[model samples]
Target: MQWRGRRQSSNIEDRRGSGGGFSGGRRGGGLRIPVKAGGGGIVTMLIVGAIAWFVFGINPLTLFGGDMGGQGSYQTSETGRAGGGVDSTPGETDNFVATVLADTETVWSTRFQEAGETYPEPTLVLFNDRVESACGIAGSATGPFYCPGDRKLYIDLTFFDQLESQLGAPGDFAQAYVVAHEVGHHIQNITGVLGKLNSARQSLPQDQANALSVRVELQADCYAGIWAHDTRAAGYVEPGDIDEALNAAFQIGDDTLQRRGQGTVVPDSFTHGTSAQRQEWFKRGYQSGNFGECDTLQGQL
Candidate 1:
């Protein structure tokens, strides 16, 4: 990945230094205090969380923005470093994110304009441990997610390191695919697909619900591919980038995650498509770059 000294995202809300402050642990025990859960998190954290859970075997400590899952309120302290967390230098991470986001903005804006609709740019927030959002409070553990309530994208950049180093998926395009996937969720929310899904999930069986969830995930993958296609047309993507994304899609398949989650894989419990299916759908979107081709619900699964 040739990502360095590139354009960084100005839309980012940096809060790495303002993590949940640490209070000294119990006497002689020295237990680390969990930075107040989801205080500083952004939408990207949800993506990190999901991918980390499905990809890496370990869970991250915090996320960047606040999400819809905020169970409790938290305020990131300017108080003191609980453990002197990594200083925020969003160079490569911020640059890659900005380019991808910029690409999405261009693609969606044009696509919507073609249909006589206006596309609203989504905000991306980068944080360290946890953050508060309109949806609710989320921690780094919450991963990268988009909250429909705020229309923002939250992420913990730390998750990127986890993705490449631990999760088995490496490369800038893989990270870009993750962002594109979350943005896809934001698109679904805006287009009313989420509303319909929420309604359907309430009345469906657990297995059926999982099936729909898988379709939703796969659609997001397709949308990510669509973004890639448009981005490539704009001279952003280079050789082998597509392979990184495809490998990511294949690596995080529902079957793979299920196998990791449970000793045995059960297709009925799958919330994301199998490896081959995901790769195929992503390729479909990438090759065609057509949103119409991403109709997973109406087309073959």
Candidate 2:
């Protein structure tokens, strides 16, 4: 991906060394619930927690406390770094993240404007170890997530290392796909799809809820592809970029991850779709580059 030298997003919150404490900023006050569990390790805990929170209508925060409170400091993307224990100079990875985020902002804003609507840009919080959001406290293990409660995206850059080393999805484009996927969730949140799914999941059984969650995740994958589509049109995508993203979607598919982790594939428990479904949806959006092609909820998958 040719992301360097491009605009960087100013809506980034750098809280890398803040010890996952609370920040008294725009959206504040969340309990610091450390994620500690045995057997499944950190990644497993994250996947299970994600399924519970996203598919089963269970709020991870509610399991520990009502609201979180603490004192911490952070730096915006434009400010480089803050006085906290964070590094004084932003690194290459940080620059890449901000650049990708800015691209997403540009693409989504243009799309929204074409539809006669204004896009509300989301803040991307970069943290280390753990972080607090309107949703709850999340450890680095929880991976990158978009909190609908606060309309912000949270990521620990270390997760990208895991994505390459453990998940077998390497390349800068794969990392961009991950960021775009989370941003896709932010799109869902602003469009009311996330709210509707949360409400609908409340009355559904686990299996049915998992099915809907799969659709939602696949839609996000397609949305990520939409971002990639725009990037390609702008001549930023290099050779093999789309393939890198596709590999990432395949590596993180529910079936692939389940088989790798548990030695079995349980379709009923899949919150995200299977490898083929994920790749297909992403391809659909990438090829069409139209928001109408991303109706994973009603259209054929």
| Cα lDDT of model 2 by residue, 207-287, tens digit | 997798788888999999999999999998877778888988888887877777778888898777888998999999999
| Best candidate, TM-score | 2
Q: For every model shown, what is its TM-score relative to the native structure?
A: 0.75, 0.80
Q: Backbone clashes in each candidate structure, one number apiece?
A: 41, 2
Q: Candidate 1 — worst ten consecutive residues by lDDT sum?
A: 72-81
Q: How many residue pairs clash in model 1?
A: 41
* lDDT for model 1: 0.63
Candidate 1 local lDDT, 126-178, one digit each (tens): 76666666766666654577766677777777666555543456666777787
